[model samples]
Target: MTVPPADNPARFLGRADAYAAARPGYPAALGAWLEEAGLLSGGVADIGAGTGLFTALLLRAGARVAAVEPNPEMRAHLEASLDGAVRAGQLSVHAGTSEATGLPGGSAGLITAAQAAHWFDPARTVPEFRRVLRPGGRVLLVWNDWRAAQTPFNRAYGEVVRAHTGDDPLRVRVLEDELPQHLPGGFERHTFTHDHPLTREGLRALATSVSYLPNQGDPAYPAMARGLDAAFDAHERGGQVALAYQTQAFLGCLD
Candidate 1:
């Protein structure tokens, strides 16, 4: 399958299923912290809320949420999965991006971008966030940093992914830069350990959900599968392998 160009906003169009199935959610502890910090009050705009992974968490915490996503396919999944919340007036889904949220000025007290800040152009995103946010509103940037720790399984899994990684320009898996610099003043950083328990098939789906990595139909998928299978075999216990991640978060207000 031909990969979509890196600039294509709908690049994730077809991978929504795998992504929704395999991607991990933010830690419950993190949500509790946000509540304790009073960040989740007044309502939230979950920008780049792909498939509503983080959006669901916000809803659970009793925050009135507006989920904004650009890709129809991914947004469809989110809407479908959270239709109950929509009907109950707990959630609203919008088709938008960080640079252009399509939300009213001062509509939200908080804005969040989970596993999506790397794709945002902070110049526009920061201003857009500021517009939608109420006075002194905060923005939360979250990512499951898979490379934050060096572990046996992580090293082997990294090798498997790197082996077949082509010149896929859309492969912006990690945020090389921090978002706090753009969100001057009011900033605090925190991290929590998290893990996803995956069976062999779940492991494959997790890797396939990565657009840069080889998918099920890609030519390199066979080798990728074998490599990942081996990694799982080496690390699996009780019929599952625990994939480790550091749930890193940056909470700050735009100046």
Candidate 2:
């Protein structure tokens, strides 16, 4: 996986709804892992809570959620989409980022980054995470990698992105190699795996939600779409295909 020298931070903000519709949610097993870790002691801060997807899962698990997302478009979408949860006081949406997080020192028991960890500058954010967490508090970094080699449909889909997108953060696994070395000191690592089913439309929406695609239209976007369509045509069974995921979770405890 080649890392493109481009700033893709604000890319998802432009396609908030597509992101909400296309992106897969966290697996129940990871949720259970967080529950077992007991970092929800001061409740959980869903840092980088884009579109409140992970926030909803945390809320459903009965964890009080303070979702911090930097992009206004994403924050606004989260606010609108999460009204019911907000009204019920299960969730609160805030504007912030991994670096310079707005929460008070030692105020969070658990800090989680879901699919957004790669975007952060770990050198600065790791210490900031330490500052915000109470002693022994945990920082959970998570990602959902589509298993291209696991299924034919998945492999074909992977080919589409490889052929079109220049730099896709979703294309590879780097945490065990990248994250641990990037943040050293006090922390432990754990991993959990899961899979999900997606309809052909779901897969298409997923491709469209990627940051590399054009906001509206681009020559490459349609080609990527066509690649997905072809993959779906070959793999659709009973109106759906199983997309296997290796859901990786890295839990680091602050000393």
Per-prediction TM-score to the true structure, in the order listed? 0.91, 0.88
List model 2 lDDT by residue over 56-167, tens digit each: 7787677888899887887888889889888988788888778777888887788888887777777677788888887767777777887533667667777777787654
Task: Give the local distance difference test score of model 2.
Answer: 0.73
In model 2, residue pairs whose N, Cα or C atoms come closer than 3 Å (at least 3 residues apart or on different chains), thus clashing, are none
Evaluate all candidate structures by whole-model CA lDDT and list the values in order.
0.82, 0.73
Q: Mind giving the per-residue lDDT tens digits that candidate 1 earns over 16-99?
A: 899999888879998888888888888999988989999998888889999999888899999999999999999999988888
- Candidate 1 local accuracy as lDDT? 0.82
Candidate 2 residue runs with Cα over 4 Å from true position: 1-8, 166-174
Question: CA RMSD for every model?
Answer: 3.1, 2.7
Q: Residue 194 error for model 1, in Å?
A: 1.3
